[model samples]
Target: MPTYISAVFNKDTRTVEFTADNGDKLIRSGGSLAWLLNNPGNLRPGGKYAKMIGQADTKSGKFAIFPTAEDGRAEKRALLRRKYNDMTLYNAMHTYAPESENDTAAYLAYVRKRSGATDQTVIKDMTDEQFNGMIAAMEQYEGFNAKPETRKERIVHATQVTLSDGARPMPATPVIVRSSNTGEKKVTTNEHGALPTFITRQPGEVIELFLEESGKIGSRIGQFALQQASASLVFARNMMTVGGNSQPHTPTQPSKEKRTPLRYVVQPGDTLASIASRFKTSVDDLVSNNHIRNRNRIYPGHVVWIYGKAPADAANDGAPATPTRSRQASYSVRSGDTLSRIADRHHTSVDALMAANPSISNANRINPGQKITLPVGVEAVPPSAAGSSRRAGNSGNPQTSDRPSLVKPPPETPAAAVRPPASVQARDTRSREGEGHPIAIIPFSQKRAPWVEHAYAQARKWAGKKEAEISRTINFHSELGYGKQFTTLAGSSNAWCASFVNWCLRTAGYAISSPHPYRARSFAADTTRFSQIDEPVFGAVALVGTSHVGFVYAMDRGRPVLLGGNQSDQINFVRFNPATLRYYVPKSYLPFAQKELKETKLDELAATDLNAALGIVVAKKAGDNTR
Candidate 1:
């Protein structure tokens, strides 16, 4: 009996390689494997499938290839199960199915033919070899490999571009779609204002679209993620003409009744019941008349409708009623004479005074000498006269004694409070660079901190140097007591990538603390102290995993260009995939160079003295208990 072994098909080399238990390597071309697959009965005398063109080696207990029909089928079945699930297979079929008038029916027919079964045959019913062959054919047709690419692709689902006037579709409008991970593509709209599919994209990747016309450069329309199988977007200007008319569109005017409602502008501390009481109406009437969504949500300055009759003078074309001596009193507005304050003093509602003084445009801005009319003895209503007086008021007239007086004593001048000088006022000092503003608002030529520039300058001096040179430099700095300080901070023989970053920072006048300035993991763990940004910034420390650290020099082709040591045993600039980046430690967290200890003073300190001083400074920065 011959022993059967599992084999892997290498698509790149076009060869099949298998390993036996005795560590012997067996090799065969893809063409030979295909032949053996088709012809299974041609076994050699040594119980091995004879090579098509090579002599067979008759070593003791040497493994031989069994016919695929007898053994390879089982191995292929297991491989398929491990590589693809049912959903993945179905999705691939759906994505790569043939284009036809009736796609669903055509896809079913294709699957049936490939599986060699009836139309009703399900994928689960097909043999593993049949499923694998069908998938392979589909992949080839789609022009993609079995495994998806790590980089993202852009898939345009739908686009609709319209003219600035919106009178017609914007045909031939140039559109650009860019993926940060996969570059960009440009296309123009067709006559129907529809964008053509440019590329296949994976879901969750972000894409930005830009539109251009005439000789003007493109403006960004929007940025969105490819979350669905299809996306529908429309790009249009803010201003547009009405229909096809030459005139610019204008909003329609509201109806007269809606424009002029019998409303009371709410005052501070006024509630639904208080408003209704002042209007001599019920809360239910107020709620129903205004369609108030929430009775308790009415705030000061909000206008609420009054369903019942307003004063007789209030009926004169929405103008404030001129109060006669019998019904009102004049009050002089003094400093700090708010409508609410006047209303409270006169035992009347702000609505009543507003109804009497229509000349006062803003109730809150009444000048000290401005004369305002007040409803006198109107807010107070006896229980017996409430209903009848309300009815009379609704009839456009009411007894003077029925309501409370809105009149009050003239307001007096208010004393002004003294203020502190500008120098004594507290202010925020946090650096606002690259924050609270659009990315475009930040200038490309913005100045960096002195320490950041110095750190980058130091790193650039050793660029392209290998481990020996880096080690020699490290030893030179260590002999000056820096090595003893670092060893006390981090253990010996540890990876020195983070140590190099800290050394550059410290040499450039940044004060780095224990654990962090030595260990990469500890530095990454101090996330709260440093701002974590999504995009890499120049001179910022880039953390890869919890081990490697480097300074981001620039962005090259959507990846971080890093300058760090211990990368391939060298201090060189290298491009790292954005996916490998774990965190970006912002340079803004480091103190300015001018704020660091003087270099002459630092040079005189011993290793122990420097460590003790650093510990005290670290504790103070962290607000730790020194005792």
Candidate 2:
């Protein structure tokens, strides 16, 4: 079905129906008026009342929301940032749409209406892809390149117009016809759906805005006055098949002593964190070694590895050394993984990935078996890391996955002919098809109920400024989207609640990486996020085991509540926990987390300072071991 934007500008409303990509949902239909207040970007998906569920699900693109007041230079800078990030994310992250192209504008008004800016205090909108791309590009400049950047075109208006019945400017005769530099005639209207007759020209041509109303002189709306659009990235081959995939990425620290091997054929309900603790290792070691596709979807009979077993005896008499030092080892590249995703799998921040693989571009792509070096940096803090699972004899990695362990009939499985390695993936599974082809995670539970309210409030807050929320909401309801840690462990088809919350924070001007999925729980963004919480931070990204992924407005009882799309039935607020309080088992395999937005973008928001309001620090502890 087609969606229409019955939007109003300057006290007039019109309904313009355009084709909406499959997953784009109409969460909050726009009204006749919206106030321009606080950080508009904060009002993105999972943030504002007027939102869509996800990105537009295009080929590849970027969105950048500047304050409608930001001058042309700043908007350009933001676009540059998004463009750089797109180079990485469109290829790496597992969003709904990947590897597609997109166009960009400084503010929503640029696309929705032909509004010009002049130090105006009016509100505007942007998208997650726009913010992610800009930040990714910035991170690359700062030497953090595991993730990709955003890409978009300089805004352009065709040198054309639609013919109107006549130009009396009444509700009925609202359109007008005008002549063009091409010696051709074009038409425009002052109708409810049309902008007033104006001749906005392309570069090297001419434009004249013959205002039907007096005192409305017009000029160029964008640099179409004198600039060419940004260039698109060129590729030589499929990166995986090309030589780019096998770059020699080195670890941050020098080689450490050999760690023991911990092997487990997945048992029923076994999780990544549980296996890591059982072998006295870290989640990172497990993720690096295992190359898990999604942390929440481990299956029974799939072999997962940890560090505890001895090396093969060379002479059949050699004794195994103590495994305490190294504790774990692994294959870095996996199918469908990028540096950021890989970093998240290991529970480390993106900076750590850059530290280890300095040679990889923050905007670069990595291939399966890319031989990336892992860092033995910060230790993880999963609930089971304290040994409760081992005491129950449930710590092995090879647990019985519930996903129909009997191998599917040869024709029934897509990867069957390939004999996939257990968990440790190393190929690209992302595709262009949406709704019909999506990735999802298990639904982990949190410890509290009110988390849902908090999550909802937070999500609405971000949606106010972002344009992606509508699409994300619509997609999730359609089985084309996916979040959080508890859900990761509790079980998921491909949950991205945590990822959603993280997206929110980033949109609101916080720098964060995606959390590793072996996680079981998480909290709201605060100084503690970079410090206590061991994961990424982005507005709309989820915290595991916290409630489901959505928005994190604030924290209560050390848990995060969320407002998200597609929990069981619709998009709404729900409390979640990292301590396994609740869960939603997928009834059947439906495509999920499918259509991603364009690419990484810049144009971040200025998030409210939680520390000043609540008197708590928001960054990592002062003395913690960090890279």
Top candidate on lDDT is: 1
Q: Give the root-mean-square deviation of each candidate in angstroms.
A: 35.2, 27.8
Model 2: how far residue 169 lies from native, Å = 55
| Root-mean-square deviation of Cα positions for candidate 1 versus the true structure, in angstroms | 35.2
List candidate 1 segments past 4 Å from native: 1-452, 476-494, 586-627
TM-score of each: 0.22, 0.19
Off by over 4 Å in 2: 1-262, 265-416, 422-497, 500-627
lDDT of 2 at 409: 15
Question: How high is the CA lDDT of each candidate model?
Answer: 0.39, 0.28
TM-score of 1: 0.22
Write down the worst ten-residue block by lDDT for model 2.
587-596
